[model samples]
Target: MNIDIKADDSPVTRADREVEAHLREMIAATYPDHGIIGEEHGSTGADREYVWILDPIDGTKAFITGRPLFGTLIGLLRDGRPILGVIDHPALNERWIGGLDYPTRFCGAPARTRVCATVENAILAATAPEMFVGKPAFEGLRQRVKLPVWGGDCFNYGLVASGHLDLAVEAGMAIYDYLPLVPVITAAGGVITDWRGQALGLDSGDEVLAAGDPALHQAAVAILKG
Candidate 1:
């Protein structure tokens, strides 16, 4: 699993790759026929009953920059719906795991979102502002809400799930980026969906919005819908 830390100086040391490789090997040996898809390495074994998705280093840019926002994301999907999720940020000394029977935690503490009233009071996050094609819509959203407090890669999603941030919006993301997050956020009593307010499925390809509360989610959706 040795991962070479690229010139970017990200935290992409062998630990990142090794962890995913170890998990892949374990899944393969245990399940024997399960599928695995990873960020560093590609996919293998597709026709199985369960599929494991891995993002060994989710916030590579931040990782390279020596930021502690990167995390190891692992997700298990059954029939294309995530059934289990784990987000580990060792540098931050925090980890979150959720599934059918497992309890969710943040740094070994129970985590939940804070109650937010109108968009004006909510804390919003996004991966990048320029990525949003509907600039006017986004500006409208900003005008109607509290000043966003954070914007970056997977860190935004992590913040939303941990209740540090209220909503996270992003455009131009892949399944691997969003899949592991769906169950984690939802299980934390949050709402995640496309900008259209449609349920975000495994096959979805559009902007994403995840909110700590349903009301905030709906309000964000309406702003994006405009």
Candidate 2:
């Protein structure tokens, strides 16, 4: 589908809208009482007991630039808490899924994050440095992690969940942008939280930090807090 600009100046494409619509339609047909929230479309029954979150294209800019790192994010929230998630990179033929009771799976096999006890040796990533424009917390992280990469979008979180990347820090994220990563990373033995080390939810703020090791996560949180 062709590309277009949203009111917020972010890129969008017909594919995003069409895929979200199709997913919403299928969810509604299968679970008529369930709620649905999507980036392309607004929410329906969001206050219900169960809600499905969808981001048909998680990295529209990457997709527009012909980068296969963009992904489709699908998350299930129970009472405003994420319980299930899926990050699918169709172009890369990679997919990761997880849930409260379901083990994280990458390309149909069980997945787990690695143990990197220190940020100095951790492989770090974020969607872009610009995402941290006014957030000093990110700078604190920037000075700590080794070999920080500039781009990955949701793909980095998938890598973290698959034991490939050690950490991912993102700022200025919407609920849909970070929700899917929660289940994926947490289920993979990683930790994801806000800069304050608080749990994330539908009403969480923009800043997010994820780490493969709990010790590394706490270290980053301490740095952000300091």
lDDT of 1 at 132: 76
Clashing pairs in 2: none
Across 122-174, the per-residue lDDT of candidate 2 in tens digits comes to 98898887888878877877887787888989999989998889989998888
Per-candidate clashes come to 5, 0
The C-alpha stretches of model 1 lying farther than 4 A from their native spots are 1-19, 101-103, 133-136
lDDT of each: 0.76, 0.91
- Give lDDT tens digits, candidate 1, residues 1-226: 3346554343466656777788888888898878988866778864456888898888776776678887878888887778788788878877787665554567677667667757989888776666676557777786777777544677676677788898888876667777788777877778888888877656798578888888988888888889
